[model samples]
Target: MDTSAPVRILTVCTGNICRSPVAERLLQAGLDQAVPGGFEVASAGTRAMVGEPMQPISADIVRTFGGSPDHFAARQLTPNILRGVDLVLTMTSGHRGEVLQLDASLLKRTFTIREFARMLDVLDQRAADGVAEAGAAVVPSTADAHDGASPLAANAAYWRGLPARAAGVRHLSLPADSSENDIVDPYRRDPGVYRQMEDQLAPAIVSILRHARLNAPSAEAAAGPGS
Candidate 1:
């Protein structure tokens, strides 16, 4: 059997009631099914409504995606919150700036969610294009060898190394418009904006979950300790 600490992920937005919470709940739900006990996801805002529940529209989106919106309260981002997180997904590049401002050490681990998704897509594409045997080849690390390891161990190593691997291929996939990398906030906005929020955020979430489920090693790889 493989035993390792769960990977921690944090999502960020402005008010915390909108984008980040939806991302947090949906990611947590999907990862529960995808990797099960392998990840933890949470959210906070830079200027959080700090105790407010998720906005109704955003809550709807979460439910639509098979996630829960009950019992959520907004929180402000802090260095303490950033501690021990393996990945940080922000709603906008500006939010990304704020996160890095709080903790520069997370520079490699933090990314605009859309940008991160695209980077992962690029890496996934590279593996398909046969540019590398595996996307991990882009970073050339001696770590993360999957041979005879439990599926959980393999999954952990692959994902822990993912930020660097994704970062390596990012330049190849820049959006034509920089704003394309951000999910528009829908706090107190009209229906169109809510649609825009879902339009932008859902695909990124889908892409992330897709990558996780696809890349997670199969059960056959769980060779157990001392195999």
Candidate 2:
């Protein structure tokens, strides 16, 4: 798969108004900052609240994270939407299963948002090592390859290979504890529940953006000292 074309990513949840939209916007915002025209992000519900705006609290949270919730409306998930998407991120394990049921080939690309996050650091490290090894084999030395482009451009080229690297990541073992892989739905709950959702989601989203070679402000803060 030549990922040189725009990488289309879809986020799925039970209702489009809550988790999926939040993930959609955050991923978009991060990708916009990272690789301006390189990616596209969208969201849909397995069981939609069609034509509805994002839940007020969800919209508020989106704004808090520097995403505009303006003019947003819910849409139901469909096979057409999944047809060309490069990635599918779901809020829970069940949602991941639902997406896979719709299209089994998506199994290599679809993952619970939390599960993907947990696996990302290892995947990224593996990719970096692979890139370095390949570069060494072909170019002889990193110093010699610097003659053609600016460092930033070279860095971008390296990260652009991530989608392909992701195939290997998909085959790696996932953590055994399933509960750690889910993001509980907080719909109809109090503000505290929403906050809890944010706490869980914020880090996972950051990890994802990082794996995609995107900059995420929240992820940076979360990584403060050791990171």
Give the top-scoring candidate (TM-score): 1
Off by over 4 Å in 2: 1-4, 125-164, 167-173, 214-227
RMSD of candidate 1 to the true fold? 3.0
Candidate 2 RMSD to the correct structure: 7.6
Q: Name the lDDT of candidate 1.
A: 0.86
Report the alpha-carbon TM-score of model 1 versus the true structure: 0.91
- Whole-model Cα lDDT of every candidate shown, in order: 0.86, 0.72
Residue 19: error of model 2 in Å?
A: 0.5
For model 1, the superposed segments whose C-alpha errors exceed 4 Å read: 1-3, 133-148, 224-226
Please give me the total number of clashing residue pairs in predicted model 2: 0
Residue range 1-227, candidate 1, lDDT tens digits: 23356778999999999999999999999988988888889999999998999999999999998999999999999999999888999999999999999999999999999999998888777767767633555432223344566566666677778898888888887999999999998888887898899999999999999888867666655554455
